[model samples]
Target: MGRIGKTAAAALLVLALSACTGGTPDPASSPGPTAAPPATGAAPAAATDPAGQVSGEAVSLETGTDVGNGRPASSHDGLMVRRRMVIAVHPTPDADLGALRRQLDRVAAERGVLLSDISPDVLDPVVLEHVVPEVIVALPPEGTHEEADALAGLAFGPVGSFTGVEHVHVGSVLVHDLQFRIGSADPAALAETIASEGILSDALGNYSTSLDGGALTVGYTGPLLSDELVEAVREGMARGAGVGPGEVELAPRSATGEGVDLSAEPEPAETEGAHASGRDDSGH
Candidate 1:
């Protein structure tokens, strides 16, 4: 129905699918998707879809950049299609996001994530009027999960303050050292809420859930959260890893072997655009 409603519905779709297949039980005991229980005597099939399409969860994938001479250079093909969301960043007036912009660009290239809009030149601008890009897949290269997580944490700084929105739970996920960790919110509960409860959805709808065993195992590299939210993060990570909330073992330190502050980072300068710089009027 609405933007927030759509996001919420998407979340429900994830949880419902998990329950139908007995994937993961909701921690809150909320009603989830319903499907006939797997036949008692039947062996689990090769986990194939009718069309023989393999599920992403069953496969371990690593996306790479294409430096091709034969193919065209556009964001429409390859890993770009796998993207599911977009984040547009613009700079504030009298403040240049040059450093931050470069960091994002480098992170995107390194992680297999894509950068949708805005250019390098506009990164150091005075204002960004209107710019929105669809997000999909990791941008940073492989082997930098923690770094990517930290960047995601910073990227979601603005939206993190909202009451019902646990920005990290729905934001970017990172892969690191072959271990899965929740990188966004400090308290894993926020992620848990996002995973367990359809905090963003409306009743009576069909959607998909992305938090299967496969989604949870993805690791992250990022900054720490406030002391208050760290435990939530631990719980959230455990859930993502399929450990369940009750079975989680939250250490004082993070899976990345570091600490984080839950307090929000200093607000990015207020500019006219999503990027730290004002929006660009020049036609590209």
Candidate 2:
């Protein structure tokens, strides 16, 4: 299968498994026309404009640094296995979308980057009033640092006549298949444990968790995925399931372009216990 098709198939498989296990449905699974909210959290009350649109400057996320202009810093390099760029554009209420799309197309073509998807901001209802637009672009894989840098430059750099660029994020796509062998444990409880631990929260990055049978698949895109972060997640899942940390297994795979593979067999997670005391050695 082609790249996009492969990615889609992998995602569908995960969804199908999630459905069988009675996991929460992904928003994408919902049918019919629906508006998409903001990619990040709610805009600060102080940052809202008269029209109820959050100012672009106020949407702060830890995913990518805000470099002046439309360009964000290069977030893909040797250390990163995969990367994707989410560019949130805040246009005027009456701005011409056709012209903006054309401008985006031109930029993508010029930079040789794939313009993956574009959608309206529906995550935040307030932002919907402003009709913010978000663009998703795929970056080069590992070993193509130069191409990744060029793409970042084009994205964050100036675009003709298109302004009000909110936030630009470039980060890794971290995918993991979590295996829990605990007997009769509730998936909901496990999910709540992971969420409450703040490992999958927006502060960590944009992430999703789906349960299929006894396995939980998590996908996140933002910043870097450190061993410490992964360990924390494992520990939380174990604690949530009422099992030892060693009982939970995590198999992780990262991608920079498109699609995710969640079918791969998971490996036993590292048992070194980076944060066994609920605190890093550095103490935050």
TM-scores, all candidates, are 0.22, 0.35
In Å, residue 109's CA in model 1 sits off its true spot by 13
* lDDT against the true structure, each candidate: 0.27, 0.35
- Which regions of candidate 2 fall more than 4 Å away from where they truly are? 1-80, 83-159, 163-184, 197-199, 254-284
Best by the lDDT measure: 2
Q: Quote the positional error of residue 223 for candidate 2 in Å.
A: 1.8
Query: Candidate 2 lDDT (Cα, whole model)?
Result: 0.35
- TM-score, model 2 to reference: 0.35
- TM accuracy, model 1: 0.22
Instruction: Tell me how many clashing residue pairs each candidate has.
Output: 68, 14
lDDT, candidate 1, 90-141, per-residue tens: 2223324454455456645544566533111111111112222122223323
Please identify model 1 stretches exceeding 4 Å from their true place. 1-129, 135-137, 140-218, 221-228, 236-278, 281-284
Best by TM-score: 2
